[model samples]
Target: MSRQAIGKANCFHDKGHHADCTLSSYPYMAAFGIIQIILSQIPNFHKLSFLSIMAAVMSFTYATIGIGLAMATVAGGKVGKTNISGTVVEVDVTATQKIWRSFQAVGDIAFAYAYATVLIEIQDTLKSSPAENKSMKRASLLGVSTTTFFYILCGCFGYAAFGNKAPGDFLTDFGFYEPFWLIDFANACIAFHLIGAYQVFAQPIFQFVEKRCNRNWPDNKFITSEYSVNVPFLGKFNISIFRLVWRTAYVVITTVVAMIFPFFNAILGLIGAASFWPLTVYFPVEMNIAQTKVKKYSPRWIGLKVLCWVCLIVSLLAAAGSIAGLISSVKTYKPFRTIHE
Candidate 1:
């Protein structure tokens, strides 16, 4: 939600008015948050298949558009041996900075492809079948492969076109003198896709919180009929009042945080650093090692555990660097300092 809000805010950046500028993200965040909450309140998770399709379509459309734009730039004779000046590009790099950036790149990769975070839930959405494992394996393989290809393709083309002039966000790297309709379309697609993605991720968190709240304040089956709705076309549906309240509150809290700290890269880096190792690397390896009963200190066990240890150390360093970077950003931060800024 925070990242989405920040992205939306970038759409209308005004540099002169620095203070209270990022307040623009608040309305956008609230609007999308409402959409997410409503969609998440759907009776069953499986019913979100339509949303998933929309997410996929929107994502693919924007990705294709972005790639097309990059290729067009390259074909238009924009890229050259001479680097473009006055662009937000990273041309020079020292060894120390490169090392820090490698750690930063880990976080960016984690953010881009953090499938492990919701793999279990996504698998659960699949229909029960004898070949469920096979089906899921094939799906995962194809999805990851396709996404990876696109990622690499886009990166290669984008770098080729912009060279050292690429900004942090490739979309915004399209110079601003001309308000490209394609850029607007791309941002809209991104925002629309995020509406679905937010619900997919937030639904699980909502369910977890609802469960905890239920344990604390058990729902009374005998509650007033107002909580139960009998729509003419939609049949009777029971709405958990407490569930609605808490989820709505959660959306508000996240929105406020997004507005207060509109640093998208920093927050993403932080989340990636925090979740990359535990959710993606350590848990899976440890689970496999335990299931296989790998002998303690054996080469196999050591090798398996070595990845986890390496991930832990690297992720910690990344997280520390991310935090330091975020602090520095905060210290020098100005609100709505133009899109390129």
Candidate 2:
């Protein structure tokens, strides 16, 4: 998405807004993947606090820029057509398509609040003085609330400005054409943020896989041994042959997969839908009920279960919708090509 943002911004800057700016996204994705491959070599999660902090700053920067740009568009009296029925069956969109898109929106929203995946990692870092869970809860609440509010502003105001024609990414996807430098900087921030964010998520998966391999092959030097390399003005760095091979292959496969799909909204929606119910709703709710020893079939327990079931149904529907979208995208998808959102 950041790659597309930068390319689109450059395209708009060079050519007029209405000019043809279509280009392949393969190189950009590959470049981003290579960066991740290097970052993936970081030896410890604890070493990533600096990256996480920088990512937070980048996120704030881009989000604020997006909101400001959206408001500016509206203020300049360039609001796109809006209707009571959001995104009506027009502009080549059908009733069925609209419904599916709406479902995709649900998943997209869920993906926006995807904090659960990183929550435990963060909690692991908290001090023991204040119970970690309590501190995590308060931190989670504040973080969620703040980010949710920003997202709402971006969604509502951006929709108000662009109506049903709004792009998936405000900074990149035809939402704003002028102020090219701001758009470029915002997109750069996105790319920077993603650099750290990808490591944050991928490190855990790497650790899991490496740990499993070490356990399975306890005496295998290829998997368990680490070689140290000294650097000028820097401390010695440790590298493992298995980690290098496994991690590189993992990144390469994922990068190729991304290029194959290249439908950001659809892919994100599908992931969000698949995980929302399981990770965000089901597990947490079940854990809370179990911890509290809530009696089965009691009013509170029943209500909670009912809500959980409702979320499950919603998640299933959202997943189906996203699948439909992916199918639709597949029909027109060209490998290594960017699918316009």
Top model number, TM-score: 2
TM-score of each: 0.81, 0.95
Output the lDDT of residue 279, model 1: 87
Model 1 bad stretches (over 4 Å): 1-23, 80-101, 173-179, 215-226, 231-235, 334-341
Which ten residues in a row are the worst by lDDT in model 1? 80-89
Candidate 1 lDDT score relative to the true structure: 0.68
lDDT of 1 by residue, 67-173 (tens): 88778878888873333332232446555555565566667767666667667777887778846667778988998888888888787777777675555567643
Clash list (residue pairs), candidate 1? none
Candidates in order: C-alpha RMSD to true structure = 5.1, 1.7
Candidate that scores best on lDDT: 2
lDDT of 2 at 24: 68
Alpha-carbon lDDT of model 2: 0.86
State the displacement of the C-alpha of residue 65, model 1, in Å, after optimal TM-score superposition. Answer: 1.4
